[model samples]
Target: MNYKVDPGLYALGHPDADSPVFISANFKMSFDHLRTSLNDGRSGWILVLDTDGINVWCAAGKGTFGTEELAKRIESSGLAGVVKHRTVIVPQLGAPGVSAREVQKRSGFKVVYGPVRAADLPDFLDAGMKAAPGMRIKTFETGERMSLVPVEIVHAVKNLVWVLPFVILLSGFSGRGAFLSHALQFGSVSVIGLLTAIAAGCVITPMLLPWLPGRAFSLKGVWPGIVCAALFLFVRDVLWGLHPAGALETFAWVLVIPAVSAYLAMNFTGCSTFTSLSGVKKEMKWAVPAQIAAVALGAVLWVTSIFV
Candidate 1:
């Protein structure tokens, strides 16, 4: 979706020099949210910062919404001439990147942090720019967590398009029945295993995030991966009446599924409010290599199972 707006000053509803100046990221969604919140007969000047189309929270973590950008945008946009008040209200989520003192020292404007949610902006402004305790708190409710699932599913499907065919082709090399027959039998099972891992990572893990055991996302995801693996084995060995897989193939999948799920779950850190930039970096340093090693070893074991 195209969600970028130009970075500059935008006037909302014929703002005057006495109107308040609000700071925001140039993302279309961020700008729209701010404007919509102020539509209740309030007038203001929105100074949109260049954040490369990212929303405020993420942009702040990446440093795109930092003090330098805010100061530069204020100067370049001639904000001092447009507003009589020297104060600019920045969203609370953008606080990570911005230093209020630094911005004031550089741009000659005082920075006032607004509420965590734009929906509360009207009340915050009417209450003499004071944020209630509730407005300062950020929550990752069920709806917010589930909203990120579709993006993960889309990414999994894209990767599967190529990996699935390769897996099926390799299945034909098993020294058993006719090539096509072996491919259909073994490859179908492999596909099911892959789908189960995807569901565990992209859906089940996120759905059970809060209750999942561990603060680290990778560790939390392992529980769901284990559950999905058991379910897949049940369907394959009992319900489908397919030939039971060899010990090597079964063991390989046990390692591979959890690793895949953990990696995908770790990616969710970027989309969630529960993690910080530093924390994510620390997690990836150990988690990524471990995941790679697990998947590689699993692949070798699976290939060896075919001939033996």
Candidate 2:
């Protein structure tokens, strides 16, 4: 579904020309957040810029919530005629894309950066448009990190769906009869390994982000992948006495799980406040190739184990 609002100026609670004008991305969630934060009987004008349904921080990074868009939106929306004040409040997260000097130079409107979050807008407005130090600092707390997990899991599952069938079919390759039995035996262990990788990358990595060993998310994810692999192997071989995998398959999974986990954990770079666009790009350049190589090697070893 389309999750974007129309890009234009919207009035809230009978706002007049003198009311404060808040800048927002056209993503419905971003627009809604800004509007809801001002729901305490405060009237204002929201100028929504086209961000292609992306939130303020991401849109800013992508250059959609930028100076050119801000200037064009101001002119197109007839904002100057509607509002007497020459000031517009942009969200602090969007500061990366919007150059205040360039915006003012182009549109003749001063850009006042709002708080890091929309929830702080009321206090910022009440303080005569001055933000407290705490309001400016962006935080990536545990709750926010946890909130991003479900989407990651959804994406991981989507990728796994196409890959799982091929893996299951491969597990049955014994060059003999009884394909179903072999598939059930070896395939179940492979499925466990894949699921463990998903949990390591999508859940454990994000939850233990602060305490994780490395700065790069992919590297940080390795610890969880290793721990999950060890635990899964232990439960299967020792606790359950269900050692269906041979030596090669066991070693293959130990390599594959961490590689998959690292790749999946790298996806969280977009959702994290700790990484910059350049940093993400740099990490991906090396990490993607490494993850691919590891997974390919592991897959070869796993398939070879079935025949040998």
Candidate 3:
């Protein structure tokens, strides 16, 4: 649980009292990146704060990397005694939780907001500790979005453990054909469809957010889900060696697959760079209700289709 580093001052290289000090959260990855960025003979001091292993931006938002913690760390680390200068550079993302004036008042250390990206730290520091406009911007590029895919997949798998089994058991209750064989047939189809939907929402849509055709994360996710549904339907005959899905099966997938996908995609807002707190709330106000309706309708149709 403690995915954090020791909270204190760490030296990038041997330095005198004149060396510059930078502030960061104690997340190992964040600490590592900060240290790695400073590896090119740019000697400095890094003052780490306990953020429970979360990145600076997230920790700041959560208040773990805020004013009080920063002030406390400054006092506890004996930073006053280590340096001649009193200025400490902090990531701009932490501005939400840290008041520059308050940190200075308590710790006698002036706080300068650094660039938004840690990779820009060298340039930021070299430019007399001034951050360029570009350095302050947060862009949700493809690579950034793709970075969250592993976590998304892990969440999906946890749910699928129970969901897939439930689908298999329910499919056995279908009125047509031998129960076990029918379950196997329906379950296989369900598994592929569900997994496709999850990937569409959680992986594909996020990676292609800008081009996916909607402002809402839920809507963006649906585009991929629809495509996956169609592909699954088209290949059903060849893949399953069974007859094509009937009207109900097709309708069910069309509704539920994208609905579930949308739900999961919307949940990604917490990790997304593009979304705002208000925007997500407004989107969910209308979207959650609609998604629930779609999933419910799909379930009803699927059940009725078994006997019909």
Cα deviation at 272, candidate 1, in Å, is 2.4
The per-model lDDT (C-alpha) reads 0.91, 0.90, 0.87
Looking at model 1, the pairs that clash are none
What are the runs in model 2 whose C-alpha is more than 4 Å off? 174-177, 237-241, 281-286
What does candidate 2's lDDT look like per residue over 1-308, in tens digits? 99999999999999998999999999999999998999999999999999998999989989999999999999999999999989999999999999999999999999999999999999999999999999999999999999999999999999998888887898798547689976876677678789999999999999999999989999998899999988887777764355455788778888889999999889988878778879999988999999999999998998898889
Give the Å error, residue 210, model 1: 0.9
Q: Candidate 3 residues 135-181, lDDT tens each?
A: 99988888888999999989987888887777888888775668898
Off by over 4 Å in 1: 238-240, 277-290
Residue pairs clashing, model 2: none
State the weakest 10-residue window (summed lDDT) of model 1.
234-243
- TM agreement with the true structure for every prediction: 0.90, 0.92, 0.96
| Clash-forming residue pairs, model 3 | none
Write candidate 1's Cα lDDT for 41-72 as tens digits: 88999999999999999899899999999999
Prediction 3 global C-alpha lDDT: 0.87
Task: Give the C-alpha lDDT of model 2.
Answer: 0.90
Candidate 3's displacement at residue 272, Å, is 0.9
Question: Ranking under lDDT, best-scoring first?
Answer: 1, 2, 3
